[model samples]
Target: MATLNRRRFLALSGLSAMGAWLGTASVLAAERDAAGLLPRNLWTSPRFASSPFTVGVASGDPTPDGAVLWTRLAPQPLEFGSGMPPRPLLVHWEVAADPQMRQVVQHGASLAHPELGHAVHVELAGLLPARPYWYRFSVADHHSAVGMTRTLPAADAPVDLLRFAVAGCQHYEEGHFTAWRHIAEEPLDFVFHYGDYIYEGASQPGVRSMNGRPFTNLRNHVGEQTYTLDDYRRRYAQYKTDPDLQAAHAAAPWFVTFDDHEVDNNWAGAQDQDGTPSEVFLLRRAQAFQAYYENMPLRRSALPRNGHMQLYRRARFGRLMDLHVLDTRQYRSRQVPIADRTQVESPARSIVGAGQEQWLFDGLADRAPRWHTIAHQVSLGNYAREKDGVIVSSDDQWSGYLDSRRRLLEHIQRTGQGNVVTACGDAHRHYASDLVQDNRDSGIISSEFLATSITSGADGQGEDEFARNTLRHSPHLRAVTDKRGYVLCEVTDKHWIGDMKILDQVMQPGGTLSRWRRYAVEHGRPGLQEA
Candidate 1:
């Protein structure tokens, strides 16, 4: 059955698009009236005790014309209200052709309202396509770090080379974000963050390590699980303070989506894991969605409306690939235990519901790009294992909803849609598997490259027993690992290749990293073969 998330939220908002950010540009527009009078409560010459740009700058949701430039002015990064005054600040931004901002191309002013966490989202438009640009934010005497961003090629343009990285599941207290530093150094067009960006559970007590060595939280931070708007905002503020994460955001634009941890563990639609009433749970969800939009570089279109936020959208990288970012948590049926085999394939169960399923099917029918990268959040293959002498699949993954999985696969097989590649996370482990129907005999219809994590498992041991056994028993499964790293993807007109970048350790700084495995799928092929 479908969820009551959107319907209930829409009733509460009495509007759509959140209405908080949609009027931002208009407010800025009204700054100069007919008499050239400055707006009221606009902070122009305000000064801070210290630099407020400690969280750094970022850009995302790029288009051929422009992208969204993001930054929050927070001198006290850990405090509520961001420790800023209860007024709007007139922030100035610039886009230039050089790192030093010598050749200025675009410039504008935006209001960083206190109601919106004192964050600025400048959705720039009317720029040339397929080119690099540098941006920075300024207020009074303080300036944010110069971040590099680029516009994508036109949707109809042909592409020869496309490079990006898939990464997610970054638990802050578990370990350091060393891998983000590595990602910041890579020459990539963009990065796809498939979620678990923040862990919602409270931190552990103390002294959990091995080998007579002590592995402590990088910051030794202590906090409760996030529930209110301030809680989520504080959590994000803490995460954004990481220099490595800021570097990655400053390096390239990112396409991001949330998973269970962004709200609560294993949350499905209107239902929570604890069986809390949907009415009460949706209030917390509304707060979480609001917090997410404030911290990320999302467009005004993605603003939260009550409890719902529109995150399922697509972008085309020339004619090479079309990225369909999915929101698998907001509208789906409640998950049952793995033992409920009788309900696994029932028509009543839907992971994406009907509306999103149709949207996905229609996107697959498009004949434009050579590849369709379906960005997902959970294991989508048959991750079944022996349970009480019976094979049971995961309730949180696609295998638990066989009818939904079968419909997606059967659509691909029916339409002969080739060169489909999926990037999924939330498993905290790397998996390279072939996408087949619920019945394994239907053959491989697509390929999945599961990005492991940034530091979730705290220096995970490579090649776990599950990998060895699953690789042996499951023919559709190609490779598996427990390394704490991301996946690097390089696509050409003829083929697509993914390299699983492995980190030897993440509990300590300066851990060594390398490419441990490589897989390739040809332009028109469906299965992933080791390269």
Candidate 2:
């Protein structure tokens, strides 16, 4: 793969009329073809009869000397009661510094039991930090597809540069994953998926499924929705089979969290916005959380139990970066009704909950890094507006929890913390804003870079127009786009740059990508500027 040179990229784009620059779509297509050098027929065929491993391999939660590698034993995957045989099977895993797995670094055995859904999570330790590793799993004589992963840098190392991508909101029935196909080709250290990994309900009418296939429900969702353990597991299995998503997972390790759609849209705590009891809802939450943990390469410590999962955690990338991941949906207050948008500003309402708020403040105040990145679910900027004497508030974002947002901003400013950049994914549009101490105030404390959806909402209702209008109204906002794609960020000692990659189209196949905009934040300056 070729490295992206900012200077050359800018020069070529400036002369795009001369045909000196290739569009992102063509370049990405070429890269994808190159990466899949193996014959398509050979790659897709079943490698084993009874212990088939259909889903490709993946890894995450990387440490300096280790990382977790993952795979599922789909002996007869997707068929009813066919994912695994009734008997226990032994699975072998290996890690190496190279793709061919010649120089083995770690090897282990994990028993695939029917009780745990026949999935494997192998955590490997004692590897080098800031280095790439390759791994795969084997059942009997058949080997799973090879996967690539990497570890974070040491806590105090002075790193020169760090590269990563952030995206969320992939509704499987809405569109093809051409964006993921493109992102899989980028040379990135890791991928941060901010939430809404899969939609709980089956495909609604008017939503387009990938590869011209109908949106088939694999889980036969109970109550005509997804809530039970069987329902949740089936939904995950359906999503895990996507070729584009699988490719992206194989490309790099991922850090993930969930928003409401993982269970239901706009659900909070034990009561939804409608003020109804959530006893059944809580039971559903437990099953969904468990299924999520079973599929991802998360540590066992983050497992779900009795309808609750501990997802708020931190990751350090040498001395250059510290990532504070947030789980906004699990412990948040009830969603304010549409009629009570003004009432949401009350301090009683919480987004991260009171306890989690203190945890975040303590983490931010404890140590100073070149960049303090927050991996959060919803948009933090105030996106409310008024037109024709009528007020409109997004019931789904941090705007619905105004007091918590204010407290977070005040804490950062009061502590004099610099370079606090938030990487968000929930709203289906891309946004870059300077989060001021006060939106109307002249003083700015930090900034935010929001990425668009991976493949959600079938191009988002009027999102492009909304983004343009938002930029015009808010002077702090640098740029906005409704295109479907992800954000690739590169952080250096003195500056942090965001590349907004926009897809050509989401409702169709073979969509291409292009750098829609570029913005950079200088040291000690919270505002953004076009690069």
Candidate 3:
């Protein structure tokens, strides 16, 4: 499949591959036509008070020979409709082999429609494999900040090292995205954002206490809760406007997936936690999905259809690792209360749905790789807490889907699939544990590293009371810390190493950071060993 490009990947994926390919072809064709009509330096239309690249530029979902370049034309980002006219605008983009913008490899024009908030998603192909490229977009005299992106190595290439950062849960109101600032400076190939890019809620001022501590909200989301497409789009703009978050996006290519906060909190399938009817909830979901697709650096294959988006896909890092990005919230059953342990283990419950579950299992069973990294949203290992001497579990995570979790673990055990690691988000705390079927000391099948939130917890104390409770209760939990930060990981042929980078504070700007801990797993091992 050396000749395979982004278009052909869509063609070989699933039953909808043909339709997806045609849609991608149409987008590329439009880009080609616009490029033919207008030169990169021309087309100066005075349509804005300032430059339209307010949210900055990003690139994601890279292939061996291709990558998706993204930018939204939002001069007045917080305003409705992002301060753009109700018409389509043609934007020019270019990919260069160097940072100086010389030796241009691919350049084209993509029409940015107002319906999608004038966002440009250029699906570039036919470039050199396993290499870095500089990209930028231009509209008239407005030039976007240049972003760096890289394509994956050939599937059979012998890779020496792969470095990346895992991060998620950036609640806009709680604190600043200082962790993202630190991530922007890291020397890494890519960043895996495991969801919760934005929070959909009515903002409140002042302090809110959690774990017996007073935490303040320095910023807030504007307007009412996000339900309509315009609301969601504006919400995304609010988060994307942060300079730190934009720097992280501009730094490297990212692999992203959504958790609950991208839509409504604790939403399951078509059911909302606030008891909105399925039909109504699905309508809101459709709007949210459309806005998410518009603002994100994603390929057209992830375009929303009605209320659903096919976000579960794979990114290969040569023969070193195959990162399987999973979507758990979209197809989950309604969440049970944490106290209801019996019902939580019901056989009918599923978090990743049947089709996605099968797809992941089949991918793991296909062949042996040095690492099988499951880019999941929530914790896979059980994190039970001791409350009044009684152990209780969170219904929001894999603990609530015992049967489903068992199936995946069983597959690993049965296939002897070692070197399996789950890079997870949510829960707002850093956790590392072993995925064991029964006792913590017995039948250890895999390892999981749950990254803490980027800024969701607001100047959090280290290893707060809740984490202490969890560490005391769950023997499988190796480490737990309450901090605002991201996780850095480096993969070699023999050892997979990870470091938890914690920020000193996020309530204000220019916070300090430190590496909290480092862990490693050997190529033939399934459990984590402290480095």
TM-scores for candidates 1 onward, in order: 0.92, 0.85, 0.91
- Each prediction's RMSD to truth: 5.4, 13.5, 5.7
Question: Model 1 — TM-score against the truth?
Answer: 0.92
Candidate 2 TM-score, C-alpha based: 0.85
Off by over 4 Å in 3: 1-46, 439-442
State the weakest 10-residue window (summed lDDT) of model 3: 11-20
User: Which candidate do you rate higher for TM-score, 2 or 3?
Assistant: 3
lDDT tens digits, residue span 291-389, model 3: 889988999889886568999999888888889999999999999886776778777999999999999998887564678889999999988888888
Report every candidate's CA lDDT.
0.83, 0.74, 0.84
lDDT of 1 by residue, 1-531 (tens): 113254432232221122223343453444344323333665667999898997899999999988888999898988877778877667777889888999878776665767678878888777889999999988888889999998999999989998899999998987789899999999999999999888887876677673235666655444698998888988888888999999999999999899998899988999899989999999988888888888898987788976689999999989888999998999888998767777877889988889899999999888889898898888787775555667665799888788998999888878786778888888888999888876657877988898999988788778876677667666688888888989999999987889999889888898888998899998777898878
Candidate 2 regions with alpha-carbon error over 4 angstroms: 1-51, 206-224, 273-276, 338-342, 438-442, 459-463
